[model samples]
Target: MSMVGNPVQVGRRPLDVDLIDRARAGDDHAFASLLGPIVASGYRLAGAMLHDRYAAEDVVQEASLKAWRSLRQLRAGAEMRPWFLGIVANECRSVRRTRWWSVLKFPDVESPAMPPDDPHTTFAELRRGIRRLRHRRRLMLVLHWYLDLPMAEIAVITRSSEDAVKSEVSRAMRQLRGLIGVEDA
Candidate 1:
């Protein structure tokens, strides 16, 4: 889904703040409720980044499990979205590393047959091109463009300077544009 398609909530009420507070205090139900909104977004981010359903599912699952286990480690008043997404990105890197090791020993399988007119298939090609990028570049591109994360947060997540993040994003976008044949990717 595009950024325009996702709903935005403007302000939080007191109850919502209480829920976050309770969730941080090890309340399972509140944590579950807190996770509800992020689950689909997490899946989308992982799917777009990894370009494989199984890998994306595993990434999200691992991230979610880790988040549940370490909920209390999340400091009070911290923004949950970027923090959780950082976890997902970490899991994605793990999945990519394992896949890279496997691919060293075996070739990747061909795509299953799909109708020529399928837009989904076209999008899959774009995602495949993303997967072809180097790890840091791919992570930078996905987090910046696909997830609409700010450069500061991306730098924190990727453990780079904001200038380095900007440089990688620029380089990745150029490569992606060449692959996708567009001025913008």
Candidate 2:
């Protein structure tokens, strides 16, 4: 369980269901096993939201700890991935609110694997536009678009109505397009 590679193999085990259940019952190993698979996904989501490697790592770590501590409070039928993501998202917000991580914005130390170079300025503009969005709306858009999550699941993680998620996503998209100067085609 390196938590940094091979998502397929890491989370492929059917034991996750059992592990989640046991972890919810206070088993530490079960909790560790439960978190191993989705940790990378959590990192990816947090990384996208924060756009900083170290900050994303911090968010993931904090979210994992919180999820573990509160695992027992989760509903029985709820899936772990979204639960974990929600925690990570919250951690990202906490880190951003502190504003100490803004030092990561300099290009020299930033991760180079951002969006593709095609349409050259698209990614840069998109990043800027994303930053312009209110924090909650930005998270919703990133979780929906980058993570490819449906509105229903995003609603679950964001703790908002599906309609609200839909509206936020819609507004975010509209704002992005407006910023990019692209009219409906």
Candidate 3:
């Protein structure tokens, strides 16, 4: 998938492969290019996990730096999205562990900007229900549903087996249903 006009191609390789090759050869532009598509997803993941946009931005920035420094460790032919998300997850966990006090001190600046529609109510309730879930379950739900990743990739990002990821997603959904007061059919 070459960018339009630029037409960067490395002998029929995929765009990511070409970018990875260039990045690994000390090309900073290629590294940024590789991260371009997935950066929004990474930010969304961080915001979901951290529940604070400022902190989430910081976590993503830190994760990007780590990804850049450790680009050599990324396996060939691997999907960069999940790999980068895993780093974001790890960074979120680290921030949570070390900066617990920040949660109390930091005020959430962004309110839920619901549109003038009835579905906004349901969306707010769902967000609240998701927030009430246990951290691991919430992370799994965000990764599976929000990020739309497969169970195997979720397992890799969360550092668990595929079976465990499946079970967590199931349990999380059930818990969310319960929290939202929706009876199981």
Candidate 4:
């Protein structure tokens, strides 16, 4: 069953206890309801990490299966966002490990170069900088910036302390800036 649907508000409303109970009782729609908004973030997170739409889709699909299989193991009062996102992140890592070479992006030396200040050029440079980062740092950067997740939440997902998550995000930013180089104003 495809759980795709319009994203609803998240991070605001509390988890629906009724929905969780229904899902745990083997109700597919209840599970889908629980996943509705969270899956959107999972899809985006996978897409940014994998840099391939189809691969990201596959990762999310696999993660959803993993999540469904383990729903019974979810402890009462546990937050679903971090749990599901962690699963998606793990799946992305697995995919990257299995097919590492296919995701690498080399410079298109043969193509005509764009102007230095062009938005496309800047974005391409940013992407290259992100790719050069270590996997963990890259995930931190994407999660904090691209996904707009708080350091506290990222800490939970990464199984690290909040201070560690903050330090990593700061270091990732510095490293990315160094890789991208600074513009003298």
Candidate 5:
């Protein structure tokens, strides 16, 4: 059964539960099936965090492998998206730690093109502002704003309290507004 494009309903769907069980039992296809829908989200999160397509791909690969190995540990009724995303976040953090020096180099050719338009320019500026934030703050902002994840889920992924996540997101937004030269009104 195809898992891609399927709604994430954890134990509510018999097929999803079956796939999870088979995946936990070491069925590689089942594992791949379960990951199909959410993997693109993982890639997007990694790309936003790392700011490099190739590095993001590497991070997603590492995270996917980790999820595969730890599939059995996942609770039956729990949502898989947040748990898997947390792994991706951890992998991104590890990559950032190891490749801290790489940030000094010129931008990658694969960087998204920012068209010379009012909205696009503003978005590009905002992206630049986001890249300037501390990594943890950036991750929190991207998870909440870019990925549309809930604050509680972000807290779980970052191992911070929900209040902490809320504060960090607020601080990041204020910093971003300053960087983009937008005055609070």
Candidate 6:
């Protein structure tokens, strides 16, 4: 499945209880099928986090494996997207901490689609400014703005309260604007 398109909308998409049960019971096919949509979203999340397609792929792959191994840890009927994304986010963070992450000069991460034009700068320039953000701030922006995930879902991934997530996103945007040299107007 292509990891670039058709992200599942959280509330709009219904969870398949049967699929979850079978996957939780150790059915590989069921797990793969269930994880397909989530993985695509996870890939986007990882891509934004790691800034390298190969590293994003590796991070998502590792996250998928971790998700599979920890499937039992998922609460019954819990939303899988946030939970799996949390794993993916953690994997990206872990990869960034390793020595190899800095030795390589990975290409800049480009978003799948053109973002809305900013009067002050191009999207690519904006992305460069985003790169200057701290890891947690970057993760917040990626999860909240890039993924179009709701605050509650982002909260789950960040392990913060919804209010805290909201506050961080707002602060991150301000920091991004500052980094991009956009004066408050």
Scored by lDDT, the top model is 6
| Tens-digit lDDT track of model 5 for 4-73 | 4334443123345677777888899988877887899899999999788999999999999999999877
Question: For candidate 6, lDDT tens digit of each residue in 1-185?
Answer: 33222243333465566666678899999898778877899999999987789989999999999989998887755678888999998898899888877686657656566545653347677879888888899999999889998998899888999999999999999999898878866
Per-candidate clashes come to 0, 0, 0, 0, 0, 0
Evaluated at residue 164, the lDDT of candidate 1 is: 94
Candidate 6: minimum summed lDDT over ten consecutive residues — where? 1-10
Worst 10 residues of 2 by lDDT: 3-12
| Deviating ranges (above 4 Å) for candidate 4 | 1-10, 99-111, 183-185
Score each candidate by Cα lDDT.
0.74, 0.76, 0.81, 0.81, 0.81, 0.82
lDDT tens digits, residue span 1-185, model 4: 32223222234445656666678888999899888879999999999997889989999999999988898866656667887888999998888788464567555443369888888888888888897888789899988999999888898789899999999988888889889996423
Question: Considering only N, C-alpha and C atoms within 3 Å, which residue pairs clash in candidate 3?
Answer: none
At residue 177, give the lDDT of candidate 4: 89
**Cα RMSD (Å) between model 1 and the true structure?**
7.0
Decoy 2 TM-score against native: 0.78
Candidate closest to the true structure, highest TM-score: 4
TM-scores for all candidates: the values are 0.70, 0.78, 0.78, 0.85, 0.81, 0.83
In angstroms, the error of model 5 at 27 is 0.4
